[model samples]
Target: MKRYLATSAALALASGSAMASGLDRTGQPIGIIFEEGTYAEFSVATSSVDLSGNDRATTTVGSPGNPFQSATGDVGDRFNMFGAGYKRDINEQLSFAVIFDQPWGVDVNYPVGSSLLLGGTTAVADSNAITALLRYRFNENFSVHGGIRYQEIDGEINLAGGAYASIPGGTYNIRVDKDGAFGWVAGVAYEIPEIALRAALTYSSEITHNFTTFESYTAGGAATTTETKTPQSVNLDFQTGIAADTLLFANVRWAEHSVTDLIPENFGGRDLIDLDDSFTYTLGVGRKFNENWSGSLAVIYADVDGDNLVSPLAPTHGYEAIRLGVQYTQDKMKISAGIRYTRLGDAIAAPGGAVGVANFRDNDAVSFGLKVGYSF
Candidate 1:
């Protein structure tokens, strides 16, 4: 009974990976960290952001804004993702696992016709991580787990349109393809099979990358090199059985993004993109119906902390989201799916400080996910 119930709760969490809040593309969830026996799972998800406002550019660097060349409408991007994990128990007290994820990322592309100030301005960050972990069970209620990770990141940026008519080549374009960096994760977990309760605290070290990059301002510009790191993070996950066949779960995550600097010297030494330390919280409840079905609903929130001078690259501030998920199990396999809706908080965006746009409020997004798991 305890084993099946735990599977149900985990399945619900996997399904709930439909969307993440803030500029967080990967929720960095540890739901799969508790899987039992020899198990494997695969998941895919997608999200659409409707980020659009105004193009605040001036006639020159320190001049007043131009009202005639303004543009408006949606300029957000649609993202697709996938991940996989595998875990094997070596014995009653030992286990090993491997997990793959696209941990930290970004995608920003203003429409070519949206506004003269931002038209053709774009940026993207692509990353992938692999983690190999080992776990040891010390009795019926306590355990320890630790792991090492390898990740690679690559990105590109472009600045064009009427806003950049003053640079060395009237525009800026840079690209970075970085080598893998090593990181570590360590955690302790306490579980009570009698009450079907589990609590875990995990910390992940920062992974830095030294990118071999190229840059250009015009047709004859040369390339440059730089380095950057994704912030270190901590996650706490807890779940307990409160009623017959029902479970309650909660998670809190914090990332040290406030102190990490990502400005490359080739990019004018200005911080192109960053976040105020990020915090996300989640609460959910799941119910098992019979032996082959279970479902859950959850609420998620993340606050936009720090200075409010928003970067157009990362426009949305904070967000509140609602998610629903369901799973179906047959024999040794389970399939799960979920949908989520998020209400993004408001903020102001302006580059160059000459002219800017406020009221990036009331924005929203919808996402969907699917997961398949099998046990041996």
Candidate 2:
């Protein structure tokens, strides 16, 4: 009947969102509330990305001839992500849930022996979020949910090799230790149980964090306090049972990524890491094959509209991804496994005068995920 429960399999495939636009590592979905009865789920995802390019500097101008060769090797790296959540119905008209996810992150490492332009450069960022939500239904068709969220973030970036060579230290290590922030979420939904039809819209508030930014040079280091706000986002999620054993689902998300600018004092208070806004969408269908098996197929798309410069830290632009998953329900436990493949967009590594840069073309990734759930 309600085979769409298998959507969890598809959701697991997206857990590697640490590879999403603008250093977005997690999609932070609220799908757990969709479950009927009491349910708990845990998942792990891993992604391997290949983002590399060749040196395009035919001539030298203003330190543009750094990469040296017209051809180079791979620079993009691999990363892993994890998530878990639980949901339960408090009564006929109320439900509660607690969700854990890694909502944002960055991982980029260039080979130390690669082209001079970007060799020996790396940027790593990590974050985690916990949310508690409550939903109340006044009637059969209308319901609302709200929640409080707590998030923590920390990161380190090493700027070295090419252009950075001219700076006093020849290399700058920027580190931001762990910090926490608070935010909120609210949403409304309409559901019709007979056909398993539901449509919900949610808004996530922005969170601000202040960290002690440490800048290390080859010889000395300096520290300063800085503030940054995580981006605010909106989500529209819809799903419905189409036939005896089939279902359809779609999700639309928009995030104010451009607002999360990481600016440090050493860089004239300018955005050391600036990003553009993002709009991502996913569409999929699920089917139940028998009493114990279900499967899902989905396609993901995103439009990353921005101007990106050449840097080893951020490579590739937007992307197109596909996910396939299956879930096996046995007794009191549900197990799901999924795999995703993404074709990343091509772009000029640097916007201008920067030399030894190449067009990051033909980049792609493969991600695999597994999830387990239990209901009582």
Alpha carbon lDDT of each predicted model: 0.74, 0.77
In terms of lDDT, the best-performing candidate is: 2
What's the CA RMSD for each of the models?
2.5, 2.6
What range of 10 consecutive residues in model 1 has the weakest lDDT sum?
15-24
Against the hidden true structure, what lDDT does model 2 obtain? 0.77
lDDT value for model 1: 0.74
Candidate 2: pairs in clash: 17-25, 18-25, 64-355, 310-349, 310-350
lDDT of 2 by residue, 1-376 (tens): 5435445334444335536777776666787876778999888989888887765554331444444464346766677888899999999999999999988887877677665655667788888999999999999889999999999999998876554556676677889999999999999999887787889999999899999899888778789887898889998988888888788888888999877877877755546566668898989888888878888888889888765453446776778998888888888788888888889877666522244255687889888888888888
- After superposition, the stretches of candidate 1 with alpha carbons farther than 4 Å from their true spots are 15-23, 56-71, 162-166, 352-359
Compose the digit string of candidate 1's lDDT tens values, residues 1-376. Answer: 4765556555555544433433457765555657877898998888887776665545653466545535445656778777888989889999988988887667778777766666787878777888899888999799999989998887887877666666676678878776788999999999988777888899888877777777777656665567676778898888889988888888888887754455666666766665667788889888888788888889889876765556666777777888888888899999888888888767666554334443365678888888899988
Candidate 1 lDDT for residue 122: 84
Q: Residue 206 of model 2: what lDDT?
A: 88
Clashes of each: 1, 5
Candidate 2 stretches greater than 4 Å from native: 3-18, 58-72, 308-311, 351-356
